[model samples]
Target: MKVLIKLFATFRNERFKQEEKELPEGTTIRQVVAQLEIAEEALGMVMVNGRHAPLESQLHEGDTLALFPLVGGG
Candidate 1:
């Protein structure tokens, strides 16, 4: 399966802002994050095809996955 991955905030420093990746049929969000070398604790929000998604959510071909890092402000 192929999915589009979008990284936000500081996460883009580690990975591309957006890119397409080919993964196994049963690949999950956590697997993709792990492959990107992103720490679990750094993840803030996850979205799949415009809907909120969990780390365990399974990915599908043509799906768009967006990841954001926790942000802090005064």
Candidate 2:
């Protein structure tokens, strides 16, 4: 399956702020993280298809995925 990924914040800077990516079928968010070679800690906030999702969330074809570093500060 193909999944569209949006990166934000420091994670974006590290990953070159890729707008989209195609993932394999049955790939989980964790897997995507690894595939993209993102730092483990960079798998911060996750949204799948516009809904909050966990790292274990499985990706589906045409799914829109967004990821950002853990938001901090006041």
Candidate 3:
């Protein structure tokens, strides 16, 4: 299955802004994140095709996955 991945905020540092990836069928959001070397606790939000999804959410072909890192502000 092919999916588009988008990284936001600090997650983009030393990483790509977005890219298309060919993942195995039944790949979960957590699996992709792990593959990217991103810690689960470091994520602030996860989205699939613009809808909020959980880490255990399974990805589908042509799905758009977006990842946001935890942010801190005054």
Best by TM-score: 3
Q: Report model 3's TM-score to 2 decimal places.
A: 0.96
* Tens digits of lDDT, candidate 2, 1-74: 66678888876665666566666678898887787788778566789888898888888888988877777779
**Residue-level lDDT tens digits of model 1 in 1-74:** 88999999899984699999889999999999999999999998999999999999999999999999998889
Model 3: ten consecutive residues of lowest lDDT: 7-16
**RMSD (Å) per prediction:** 0.8, 1.9, 0.6
lDDT of each: 0.94, 0.78, 0.95
**TM-score ranking, high to low:** 3, 1, 2
Q: Which order, best to worst by lDDT?
A: 3, 1, 2
Winner on lDDT (1 vs 3) = 3
Better of 1 and 3 by TM-score: 3
Q: Is candidate 2 or candidate 3 better by TM-score?
A: 3
- Give TM per candidate: 0.95, 0.79, 0.96
> Candidate 1 or 2, higher TM-score?
1
Better-scoring candidate (lDDT), 2 or 3: 3
* lDDT score for residue 29 of model 1: 97
Q: List the pairs of residues colliding in candidate 3.
A: none
List model 3 lDDT by residue over 1-74, tens digit each: 99999999888999999999999999999999999999998999899999999999999999999999888889
Clashing pairs in 2: 1-25
Any idea what lDDT model 2 has? 0.78
